[model samples]
Target: MDVTPLSLARVHFLASLGFFALFLAIALALAWVLLLFKIQARRTGAPGWTAAYRLWVRLFALAFVLALAACVPLLFQLGALWPILMERVGNVLGPLLGFAVVTVFVLKSCFLGVMLFGQRRVSDLAHTLSVGMVAAGLLLATFWLAAMVSWTHAPAGAVLVDGRYVLLDWVEAVFNPAMPWLFASLVLASALTGAFLLVGVSAWQALQRPPADAERMAFRVGLRLAGVALALQVAAATGAAQWIAQAQPAKAAAAAGYWHGGETARWVLFGWPDAAGQRNRAEMALGRLPDWWLGRSAEGGQLGLDAYSGMLPPVAATFWSFRIMVLAGLAMIVLAGLTLLRLHRRRLDPAGLPRAWLHGLSAGTWLGGLALLAGWGYMELGRQPYAVYATVTVTEAAGDIPAGLLAGSLAAHLALYGLLFAAFVRMTYHAARYGVVPVRKAGARP
Candidate 1:
C-alpha cells in the first residue's frame, strides 16, 4: 500500500516498458519497409516483386497487430509509472502524445486497412497511395515519439513557471537538439531492422533448394535494402554518437566505459567496465583513434563520467549494449560488403545467389536487430535514474503501485507476447514456404 522510491520493483516496471518499446521499434520498421516494397513494385513492374508484395502484406498485418498490443500498455505506463512526469509536465507532453496517437490512427491505421486487404478491391494507384501514406504516417508518428524521448535525454525549450515545467516554445521543444540526430538514426535503424529480417527469412526459404519464388524476390529486396542501409547507418550512428557526446556527456562516457575523468582516451575494442574501480578489465584499446573520431577539436578531447555532473546510468549495461550495437553495425557492413561483391560479379541474381552469401545474410539479420535493440537500450538506460534528465528522477516519478501487481503484470505481458511471437513466426513461415496467395485462395478451390 505504501509508495516506494527506486527499488528492484522500479527496475522490473522499467524493463516491461522497455520490452514493449522493442516491439514498437520492430513494427515501425516493418511499416516503412512495406512502403519500400510498394514503391519498388510500382517502379519495376516485376512479377517476382508483385508476389513478394502479397507475402509482405500478410506479414505487415501481423506486425501491425502486435504493435497495437504494445501501444496500449506503453501509453498507460507513462502515466501509471511516472505520475510526476505526466502530471507536472502534462501540459507539454500531453499534446505530443495526443498528436502521436492521432497521427498513428489517421495516417497509419486507416490506410493500412486498405493496404493489407484492398489490393484487389482498390485501383493500383490507390493501393500504392495506401502504402505510401501508412509509411508517412508512421514516420510522422515516430517523429513525435522520438521528440518526446529526445527531450527526456536532453530537456529543452521548457521553462519552470509556477514551479512546473511549461512549454515556452513548442516548436523548439519538438525540434530539440537531440531530435534531429536521434530521428535520423531511428529511421535508418528501422529500415535496417526490417530489411535484415526479410533477408534472413527469405534466405532461409531460398536454402530450401526448390525455393519459394516469392522468397527469391524478397531476398533480392532485402539484400539491396540491407546493403544500402548498412552504408548509411554508419554515418547516422557516428553523427548521433558525436552529438550525444556534446549534449549528453554522461551517457557518452558510460557508453565508452570511460569512468575516470581525463584527456587521453582509448577506444575499447572489448572489456568489462567496473564502475566501482573506475576502469576496465581485460581491456584492449586503440590508443588515439576513438578520440580522433569522436572529438570536435583537433586536440581530440574526451570527458569521462566523472567529468559529468549528473548521476551515471548503470555503467555495465551502457558499456556492453553500446559495444554490442557497434559490433553488430560493423558485422552488417561486412556482410553488406560481400553482397556488393556478389552483385558486381553477377553471382547475386534473384534467381540464384551464392549459398554461403545467403547464409551470411541470414546470420547478418540478427546483427541488425541486435543493433537496433541494443542501441535503443544503451540510450534509454543511459538516460536512466531520471525520467527527464536533470529535472525528474525515475525514483521520484514512479507511482504507489504494488510490487506484486507490477511483477504480475510484467509476467502476463511477457507470456502473451511470447505466444504472439510464436504465432507470427509460424504464419510468416507459412507465407514464405507456400506463399500467401495459395493459402488465401485455398478455400476457393472448386
Candidate 2:
C-alpha cells in the first residue's frame, strides 16, 4: 500500500490509540495498588501501609504524567493533518477544531508541570490541591479529545453561509450523533481493568509464603468489584453493538458475519477478518444460524437499518467485535463472581482459591485486552475504504510518507514499548514480593 502523510497520520493515530490503552492500563493498575494499600492500612491499622499508599499514589500520578506526555505528540501529528481534515470538512468547523486542540495542549502542559514539581512543596494541603488540579486537567483533556473524535464522525453546531463558517449549533455539534455507548464502553473498560488489577495483585499477595489476611480480604473485595465492573462492561458492549447496528449497519453486519439474503450468517468464534473479501471467514465454519440467536435481525429484513447513514459499517466487523467484547466481559464477571462467592463462604484457601482466582483474573485481563483491541480494530478497519472522514477515500489521503520510514518507526516503537513493559512487570513483581513495610527511624516521619 502507498503511504502518504495522511496515511502516516492515520498510522500514528492508531499507534497513539494503542499507547493510550496501555498507559490507561498502567495507570489503572497503579491506582488499584494505591487504593488497595490505603484500604489495607485502614483495615489493618498499619501506619506503614499509609506511607506505601502515598508512595504508590505518587507513582500513579507519575504514570498519568507519562501518559499525557505520550499523547502530546499525537496532538501535534493530528494538527499537521488538520489541513486535510479541514478540506474534507469544507473548512466550516476549523475554528472549533482549533480551539479544542489548543485547549487540550494547554491543559496537558499545565498538568505536566504541576505533576512534575508540585510535590516538592512540603505542605500536605498544597500537594493535595495540586494533585486534584492535575486530575481535573486530565479530565478536561480527555473531554477535548473525545469531542474531536465525536465531531469528525458527526459534525454539528456549525453552518456554512455563502462560503463563510458560522457557529450556530455548538451544543448540537458537541453532542452530535449521541455516542453514549462508545463513551460508556471506554469508561467501563477502564473500571474493569482497574478491578482486574486489584484482584490479580491481591491474589498474588495472598500466594506469598505466609498468607496475608489483609491480602486475602483485598482479593475478595477486588473480585466482587471486578465482577460488578465486568457486568457493566457487558451491558455497555451490548448497548454499543445496538447503537452500531442502528447507526452503521454494514460494519455491524461485518462484525456479525451477516450479509444480504436469507442465508443467515453465523458468528465466527475466532478468526482474522478478511478485509478484501469483506468477511470474517471462520477457521471452522459453524454453518448458518438464525438472526435471533445472534441478537441481530431476529425478524430479518435489513433489520430496517440504513447502512450508509453511519460513518462505519453496520454489519460484520462491528457485530463480531461486540460479540467478542461481550463474551470476554461475561467470562470475567462469571469468574470474578465465583471467586467472590467462594471467599464469602470462607472456602477460599490460600493454595486453592487464591491461586485459582489469580489465574482466572489473569485470563480475564488478557481477554479484556483482546476484546478492547478487537473493538478498536472494528472501529478503524470497518471505517476503511474511506481514510479521511467518510467522504475522503483512502487513496486520496495517501500523501508523501515513505514505506521504510513508517515501518522503521513502528518497529522502534514496538521494541521500546516492549522493553518498558517488561521493566514495569519486573518493578511490579518486586514491589509486591520484597517491598514490605520498612521500619522508620526514631523521630522520623512515620
Candidate 3:
C-alpha cells in the first residue's frame, strides 16, 4: 500500500488539533477543581452537616461528571486512531492497543460512577477517593497516549509475524527510548497550564474587591503552586529539547530555520503560513538565532546533536520555544505573587497597590495564556511533515478521508465547542464575581 505524503500531512494536522482539543478539555476540568477547592475553603466555618455543604458537594459531583463526559470523546477518538496503528503495526499490535483503550475506558467509567453515587454513603472518604481515582485515570491515559506516540518515532520495536505485527517486548515497546523525555514534557505542560489557570482565577477574584483574610490566604497558596509549576515547566522544556536533538533532528532543524543547504530560512513568530516565499522565508529568518545562544561548547561547537547521523543543527527553534514558555510562565508567577503580597500587607482593602496589582495580574494572565498557546503550536508544528507518532507521514494517514466530510465535521465541532467555551467563560466569570454565598458573622450563633 503506497501512502502519499499529502495524506500523512493531513493526518498530522488533524492529530495535532485533536491533542490540543483534549488539552483544553482537561484544562477546563482542572479549572473546576480549583473553583471547588476555593468553595470548600470558604465553607470552612459552616456547620459540618449543613445544606450548604451538601450543595457544594453536589456541585463538585456534577463537575466530575462533566469532566468524565469530556474525556469520553477523547477516548473514542484515540480508539479511532487504531486503523492507522494497525497499518503500521500489522493486526496484532492493533488489538493490543485496543485492549489498552478498553481497560482505560472501564477504569474511568467505574471511577466516574463511584464519584457520582458513592459520595452520600462514604461521606468524607468520597472526596479523597474521587480525587485519587481521577488522578490515576489521567496518569494512565497519559502513559498510554505517550506510548503510542513513542511507537510513531520508533517502529522497529515491533515486527510483522503471520501477517500481523507483534510487539516483541511489550514493555520496551510501550516505554520506548523517547518515553522519558516525552513524559517529562507532558508533565511540565500540565503543571504549566494548571498554574496559569490558578493564578488567573485568583487574580480575577482578588481584583473584584479587597480579599477577605481567607481569600487572601487562598491567593497566597495559589501563588506558590504557580511558582513551582513554572519552575518545572522550564525543566521539562529543557528535557524536551534534548530529546528532540537526539531523536528528531530533522524536525528540530526545520523549526529552527536550519536546513542542509545554506539557503536563507525565515522565522515565524505569528501569523499563519503563506503560500509564497513570504511565510516560509520569514519563518526561516525569524526562527534563526546565534549559535552561542543555543549553547556552544567551550570550543564554540553546537551543544545540540546534528540531524544527520553525525551532525547537529543549530537547535534554534527549540531554544526559542523554551524561552517563550518560560518567560510567560515567570511573568504570570510574578503577577500572582505580587497580588498575594499586596493582600498580605493589609494594603489591599482600601486601595493603593491592590488595584494596580490586579490590573497587572489580569493582563499578565491573558498574555501568559497566549504565550502558552503559541508555544504549544510551535512544538506541534515544528514536527510538521511528521505526525505526532512520527511513523505515519501526514499525507498517507489522512488523504483517504474526504475533504468535504472532514470540513463538515469540523464545522459542527467548532460550533459546539465555541458555545461550550463561551458558556464556560461566562459561568466562571459570574461565579468568581458573585457566586460566593455570604457567610454569617463569626460570633452570631444561629
Candidate 4:
C-alpha cells in the first residue's frame, strides 16, 4: 500500500489527538471525582475518604501532566501539517483556542497547587474550594475546545467569503447548534470513562489483596456513577445521532450504512458497508423502532451515499466505528447493572464478588477510553475530505511536505506515545497495589 504525505499527516495528527483525548478524558472525569472525594472526606472526616482522595489525586496529576504533554503536538501540527487550514479559519478558531488556553493556565496555575499540595497547609474549606475551582476550570476549558470543534463541523455564526471564514455573530458561533451536543457527549463520555476507571482499579486492588475501606468506597461509587452516566450517555447519544442525521445526512447515512434513504423507519443495527456496491452486506436492522425513537430525517433525501459522490466519507470505517462504540457502551451498562444487582443481594462483599465478574470489571479499565476513541473516529471519519466541514477540502488544506518526512514523524510519535502509555500503566499499578503512604513530620522514622 502506498501512503501520501496527506495521509501520513492525518495519521500523525490523529495519534496525537487520540493520546490527548484518552488522558483528557481521565483528567476531566477525575476532576469531578476528586471533588466528590474531598467533599466526602470533609463531611465524614473518615480516613478512608481522605485516603481515597489522596490516592486518586496522584493519578489525576499524572493524567493532567500527560494530557498537557500530549496536547503540545496537536497545537504544532496545525501549523506543521495543515497551515492552510489555519489561514482559512484562523479568525474563527483563534479566540476559542485562546480562551481555552487561558482558562487552563489560570485555573490550574492558581488552584491546582492548592488542590495537590496545599491540603495540609490550608484549611479544609480552602482546600475544598481549590478542588472545586480546578473542576470548574476543566469544564470551562472543555466548553471552549468543544465549541471550536463544533464550529468546524457546523460552521455557524460565520460566513465563508474569499476562501476564509468571517465571524458574523460571536454568540451563535460560540454556542453553535453542534456545540451543545458535542459538549454534552464529551462531558458524559469523560465521566463514564472516569467512573469505569474507578471501578476497574478498585476491583483490581480488591482482587490482589483484602479490600480496604477506600477500595470498597471507590467500587460502590464507581458502580453507581457508571450506571447513571451510561443511561444519560445513551439518551444523549441518541439525540446527538438524530441531530447529526438532520444536520449532515450524508455522514449519518454513511455511519448507519443507510444505502437508500427515504421515508423509511428501518435502522441498520449492524452491517458491512460496501461503498462500491452502495449497499450493506449481511445487514441486521430494526424495521420500525428506530424511526419511532429517532424519527425519520426527511431532509436526508431519498438517495444515501449515492447523493454525496466524491464527498462521502469512508463507509466501512464509519459504520464499524459506530457499531464498536455502541457495543462497548451496551456492554458497560450490562456489566454495571449486573454488578449492582449482585451487590444489592448482599451475597458477597466487594472482594468476594465472583472472580470472573471481578476479572471482567478489572479488564474494563480501558473499555471506556477505547469506546470514546471509537466514538470520535465515527464522528471525525464521517466528516472526512473536509478540513472545515463543507467549506474546505482536506487536500486543499494539507501542507506541502514530503511523504517520507511525515511518515517518519508519525513513527516517532507512535513510539513515544507507546512508551508514555506503558509508563502510566506501570505507575498506576504500583500506586494502587501498595496504596498511599502518609506524610510524616520532620525527622519522623518510617
Predicted candidate 1 versus true structure: per-residue lDDT over 257-372, tens digit per residue: 77665556667778988766778889888865465333233344566777654577878888888888888888887776777676756634544577887777666655666787
lDDT tens digits by residue: candidate 4, 235-335: 89888988887777777777767666564536788778887788889988886535423324346334467667888887898889888998889889888
Q: Candidate 2 local accuracy as lDDT? A: 0.56
Model 2 per-residue lDDT tens digits across residues 194-283: 566556655566656554554554455556666666777767766665665555455555665554434546555666555445445554
Model 1 lowest lDDT segment of ten: 292-301
Candidate 4 residues lying further than 4 Å off, grouped into runs, are 262-270, 282-289, 292-302, 345-349, 440-446
Residue 179, model 1: lDDT of: 89
Q: Of models 1 and 4, which has the larger TM-score? A: 4
| Candidate maximizing lDDT | 4
The C-alpha TM-scores of every prediction are: 0.89, 0.75, 0.69, 0.94
Report how far off residue 142 is in candidate 4 (Å). 0.7
Q: Write the per-residue lDDT of candidate 3 for residues 81-107, one digit (tens) a residue.
A: 334534555443455456556755775
lDDT at 204 for candidate 1?
70
- lDDT accuracy of residue 314 in candidate 4: 74
Better of 2 and 4 by TM-score: 4
lDDT of 4: 0.84
lDDT of 3 at 337: 57
